[model samples]
Target chain A: MSNYLSLENVGITFKTQNGPFRALDDVSIKIEKGEYVTMIGHSGCGKSTVLNIVAGLLTATEGVVLLENKEVNAPGPDRAVVFQNHSLLPWLTVYENVRLGVDKVFAKTKSKAERDEWTKHNLKLVHMEHAMDKRPGEISGGMKQRVGIARALAMEPKVLLMDEPFGALDALTRAHLQDSVMEIQAELGNTVIMITHDVDEAVLLSDRIVMLTNGPSATIGEILTVDLPRPRNRLALAEDPHYHHLRGQVLEFLYHRQLRPAA
Target chain B: MKSNIVRLTPQQESPPEESTAVIPESASNAASTATRATKSVEKIPASTTRNYALWRASGTTLIKNIFLPVLTFLVVGVIWSYIHSHIAPEIPSIADTWTRAKEILADPLAQNGPNDMGIGWQVLYSLGRVLGGFALAAIVGIPVGFVMGMSENFQKAVQPLIQILRPVSPLAWLPIGLLLFKAVNPSAIFVIFITSIWPMIMNTAAGVKAIPKDYMNVAAVLRLGKLEITRKILLPATLPHVITGMRLSLSIAWMVIVAAEMLTGGIGIGFYVWDEWNNLNVPSIIVAIFIIGIVGIILESVMTLVHRHFDYSR
Candidate 1:
């Protein structure tokens, strides 16, 4: 598979009150077309920093990021991000929030009806059609996250970026959303890069799990490939030895090999 | 009868049965029998008791909210009467003030001339000035506030000037307004504008600065145009704070208008108060005081309603 997104030797430094602070150093990763990759690490390990770099919300202090052979210098519709907090505008209804992205990305090329249809279609993908008229504040946390996902998907982005999108949700809700995302990925075959702290989630959803070391200056620690069959069921996987092995491998890596001192 | 017996038996038996299972059955039998007998006798329906509780709750709330305030007003009236009868006679008794208030309100809209207009006309004239000045302040203040909020350097440059000007009494500005405009009405309005503009500018700038980083990040990621960001994100986000500023500005304007009008000598409630005081119509002056208080309360309550309407966070 051709590399659809690549970050080469990416580094980020912050000028804090105490002087220069390196958040990430010499971070490099290549994400292939139609692949679902997740970056996993403990807190403050620059997992989100990597995702932000790809989203073009942050410019690296060193190296370069390329998306489809184009330099990723600024945020655009091409890379749509589902933020950790599900940052839907409180004043807007679910439909309007999704429409905001659709209108911005497609207004020049698409008709109004086409944009509306696209918005509705994306909301339907996340089963948020029922709440299309409800404001973000009126919905449950899970429903808000679904709307966030719909908003990202509506942009018809080249790559979907998620920064611990289900981190705030309960375990059951997170599992249900992970299943929905897996199904959506299977259907659309869109490239996805997600940042997560959950080991089980990394094993369940990702084609490749890129682990990062703890930071003051963090870098990629290891990469693990999941060769599990698609259309994976959690209950069935609970009984599968291979699935258990993958879960164990991630646990061992997180706890034994690359565990943060404070954690 | 059978269904009633069934329900009562379970209700009466379950607790004792469970307790008997834990303890000795023979030991609790007499106590259980006594309790059952009392429970059967006192068979009030659950719904009726619930309804009674709800009614009592609402009655308590009504007494707390309505009755207390009315009682306080009556007590204040009694105290005022006592003080007028026993203390200095210059302060009009509540009854005397009420009588004068009735007389003034009876022909409130009557007009002999600009100098001798009714209380209603005076109030209207004052309201017009306050609103005009407030509207002008809003027009000028909101944009300046936005600019200051959007740029730190601009805020720093403007901060010292605003600090120096803001705390200077609105009455102090009256002389400057008189010098600049050389007209009573415009000078009164200029005082109102000067006083009211500060709250709007300060509150709106603070509101703009407080716009959450998450919303800005969304704007950045979406690549929304400058106009779109301002219209969709900035305006709505800062609206509650802007309304709060407007509320403060309006109350300040109302206050300054009374003092300003007293100095300017126009057909206003404030002027009416001064006129009554000059003629030694103490009761009528008291009536004017009550009217001023009532109008100020109304203005504040109206602004509070507007503020609540724009408060999207709740």
Candidate 2:
């Protein structure tokens, strides 16, 4: 498989008042083109730090992130991030918020009309075309996340970095978003790196799930390759024995092997 | 997910009760709760009833708002009259103050001397000076505040200097203004300008600091240039605070102009008050007080309206 995006021993250390704090260490992963990958671990496991490193929002102290044979040193439109809070400029309308990124990313590449159409098309993908004129604050949390997804997708990033994209959402909204994401993945074949805490979400969306050990310095504990077939249905998976086995392995790793120690 | 729960009803009823156990994801469970929420919402009072409820609440609030203030004013008037009759025989009664106010208001454009402009002209002069000073403060202070917010080192290095200057009375700046400008009108304007600038600078900086790191992260991920970030993100995000700062600065501007005008001795409300006191016309002074108060309230109301217009989240 082509190593379309690679994290070669990527790590980061943040300076706290106490001292230098090691957040991630010796972490590495290679992602193929059009692959959907998820990083799952308990809270404070530095999962988001890793995603930030790849998105070029944080500079890795130890390793380098390579995308399409180029160094990733700074954030660019090629690595679009869908922030957890939906970071829609609250001042801009939904159409304008998405259009802002589309305009910036396609400044020279597309006409104004083309950019507007592209923004609308991406919003439609997330079923948010109806609320295009509304502001982020006017929408429900689910709807805002949809717009956030649209904004990220409109940029046509090489790898979509979603930091706990659906983590704040209710389970139903999450499941709904997950299913739509799977459908969109099949249609667009865009490489995506999502950080999620939900077990079913990790299993349901990822082609590979990277589980990290609990942190002071978190590293990849295990990488589980999901063998579930395409067009995977959540309800159908509930009864599938192979699905149960895959779920059980993840549960064992998370619950038994890497269960969070008490304070 | 709703259908999932409804379809499991047969099993739930059969006492095997292992039906809910079959569910693996909380996704379906949340669906039931959401459906129940929608069901409860459907059971709410109709639109007209809700509207009536809303109207009733607003009506009572409006009455309370109007009633309490009127009651307080009446009490104040009664106390003023009592003080005039019994406690302080020298001071004018509330009725006398009102009559004097009516007379002064009746002929507000008259000017008897350099220090004795009519109340209308006095207010207009003060307002013009306040606005001029406040505008200058906003123009100079807002950009400085933005820069302070962008750099913590600058904030740290400069904040101590601001703290030292902020609390010095408006009068302390009066001498400096007079010394620098060598004229009365500009001196008064300078005093107002210097005194009112601190709030705008501080508030604008606070607004900038209050902006969520997520927004900056969004800007970065988009590879937005500095200009794009400022125009698209920083300006809009900081505007409400800027307005709040301006609101505060305007009031300070208004407040200091009275003192500034008093010292500068020009054709303004402050000078009119001082002139009336010199002439032993306490009633006209009382009228000036009321005019100053009403103008302050009107200015504050305008600022509040503007703040509300810009601070829209939804």
Candidate 3:
């Protein structure tokens, strides 16, 4: 399969009061079309920096990001991002939040009825159609994240970039929404790159899991392909014979091979 | 509550498992228990009706939230009436003030000439000046605040100048304003502008600076245009602070307009009060004072309501 997205030797250095601090060092990755990839790392390991670079939020100090064989220079409607806090504008109702993407990119091309229909379809896909009239503040965190998901999905983006979308959720809620995300991804078959800290979550939802080292400057430590059967259940995945093996290997790579002492 | 629910059923009822096993031994007791259970279930709907009614109740729920200020006003009025009747018997009573208020309302400028300053005319004049000065401040302050907020170098360079201007009182500027404007009203308005704009600009700059990195990241990722981002993201994010700055600006503007009028000599409520005091009409001065207070309260409430419109994240 042809790679739909490519990050070539991407590096980021932030200018601080003291001096320039390198956040990411010559990191590179290629993601295939319809790939569901999870980027796993410790905090400040530049996982989010990488995601932002790919999303065109930040220009890399070196190298380039390619989307569909074109250089990615800025954020566009074609690539949507779901933030960690589920940054649904609190002033807007669920319908309005999802319709924001539609309004931004598709308002000129589609009728109001068409837009409404599309919004409902995405909301229903995330099981939040009942909440379409409610503001983000009125909903629970899980529901807000689901609305964030629905908003991203409604864009019909070429790539969906998520920065720990479920990080703030309760364990049970996170798992439930993780499965919901997987189900939607399966239905839509869009490319997704999610930044996360949870190892089991990365394994359960990803086609491949890429782990990053600790940072003053960090790079991808290892990329592991998840060979688990499709339609995976989290409970069963934990009990699966291969689960322990993969988990052990990843933990070793994260805590042993790329370990850094406390600062 | 769970155990209470489980234990509350009549003991004579046949065990649920045994009955479901297709062999019931106590048919008569079971029937009575079922009837009793039906009665309890019927009561559940009545309780739910009470709950539904409770759910429908709307608006303020506490004295502090709703009626405390009104009660305090009543208490203060009672004390004022008592003092007027006994301690200062010659002082005008609330009744006399009410009559004066009505007369003032009937023909605000009647006591004076065609251009004589009526209470209503004085209030309108003061309000106009306050609004004019506050509007000018908002126009100049908000944009400067946004620029100072977004640029670190600009913030560092300009911050000291802002600090120097902040401590200079509006009253202190009155003479300079009069010299600059060469007109009493414009001079007074200028004082209002100076006093009001500083806090507004500073607060707005602080609010803009406090916008989270995550929000900027989202803006960048979405590739939102600078204009679009300002309107859609930055403006909304800083709304609470902007509204707060506006509140501070308006109140300061109101106060400065009165002070400026006292210094510059004008046809505003402030000048009216000073004029009445000079004539030794303490009662009219008192009335003017109360009117000023009432107007300030009204203006503040209006600003608060407007603030509520933008405070959705709460």
Candidate 4:
């Protein structure tokens, strides 16, 4: 399959007062166009660091991130990130936050009317059109995340980088939002790379689940293909025969290794 | 998750009591006790009454929290009046202070000296000076603070100088201001400017530096232009702290103005207080002191309200 984005021999080392800590180690992955890939790992396993590298918010200590055959040297509108905390500007209304991205990336290209229409369309897609005038503080956590997703989509990014976008939500809200995001991704046909810790979330939402090992220089431990057919139901997926096998394999690979001593 | 638990009821009942076998003694006793309680509830049909009691408990907690402070204030007032009447007649009772306060208000212009103008005019004059000095400080300090916060090189270069100047007394700037401006009002304004600026600068810088990293990431990914990001992200993000700083600075400005007026001897409430004290008019001096306190409280409260108005989040 042709690749839309690629991370080649990518790694990161953060310099601290104590010493340097390697966050990622020679990690390489290729994402195909319109493909949904989930990176599942324990916290501090360099999952977010990898997403930051991909979003060009942080540079890799080694290797290159190529998007559509071009190197990503800095952050650009081609990749939009939805942070775990839903970093909506509390001062701004929901519409203004989404309009922020549209105005920034498409100002020279789109008219005022077009921008407004685009913002409203995206808000509507997230079912936040009614709350467009409300400030971020006035909305619930779930609504804020929806606004964040709307803002990311309004950028019309070629690749969407989601760092545990639903990690903070209640399970039911998370599940509903997951379905909403999946439906949107399908509709928009944009490549999505989501970082998550929930095994069921990874299995239900991704074409491939990439698991990373524990840190002190972490790398991809295994990549599991989720053979379950879409559109997925979390309840049904839990009961499916393949679901247990896949869950067991990932759990064993990630945790069982921790029980073994160094070679 | 709620539905999941509810849907598992049949399965739970059909498990041949396997879960009971796995349960330890303490847990089984707890569950059995809870089951007995639920059966009792079913027999009585009084769970709704228990729920009503629970609701009342929450309501009582809410009312107690709100009423407690007001009750404390009333009790304090009674003790204050008792102490005033019994121990020291020299001490102004709350009613005496209020009467004097109302008398002053009834004829503020006449109570104020003919040459002194009115208390109203003095208040306005004092307000203008405070605002002028504070506004000047904000205009100059915020941008400097933003730059200092955003750039490491700039922060390192200027930080030591700021730290050195910040601790210098407002009076120390008075002499410099007098020499530089060569006029009483302007010099006094300058002193107020100097005295009030450091907090605004320091607090603004702190606010800017403390901005969440996630916001910068959002700005970067969205390709927000520098101007847009500064307006939308940087400015609004720092506003709460900025308002807090301004509140602090306004009080400082009022204090510095009073000191400045005392030193400079101008037509201001500060000067009025000094003038009354110099003339040894004890009652008017007392009046001036009370007025000053009241005005200061009002100004502080106004700033606080403005701060709260803009501060949406808890």
Question: What TM-score, computed on C-alpha atoms, does each candidate reach?
Answer: 0.90, 0.90, 0.80, 0.82
What CAPRI-style quality would you assign to candidate 2? Answer: medium
Clashing pairs in 3: none
What is the TM-score of candidate 3?
Answer: 0.80
Model 1 DockQ reads: 0.63
What lDDT is reached at residue B162 by model 3? 89
Looking at candidate 1, what is the lDDT of residue B303?
Answer: 88
Rank ordering of all candidates by DockQ, starting from the highest: 2, 1, 4, 3
- Stretches off by above 4 angstroms in model 1 are B1-54
lDDT accuracy of residue A148 in candidate 1 = 97
Sorted on TM-score, highest at the top, how do the candidates line up?
2, 1, 4, 3
Chain B: TM-scores of all predictions: 0.83, 0.82, 0.75, 0.69
Deviating ranges (above 4 Å) for candidate 4: A258-263, B1-103, B110-114
Cα displacement (Å) at residue B62, model 1: 1.0
Per-candidate local distance difference test? 0.86, 0.86, 0.81, 0.81
- lDDT, candidate 3, B1-314, per-residue tens: 32223433433333333212222323333344444554666777765653343333211222232365568779988988999987987567787877767766777755465347678888888999888888898899988899888998999999999889899887888889778988777877788888778878888898898888767765665566889889888898888888899998898788777777776666788888788767766677678888888799778878887997888764
Candidate 2: where are CA atoms >4 Å away?
Answer: B1-52, B111-116
Indicate the residue-level lDDT of B282 in model 2: 97
- Model 1: colliding residue pairs: none
Go through the candidates in order and give each one's DockQ.
0.63, 0.72, 0.47, 0.61
Q: What residue pairs are clashing in model 2? A: none
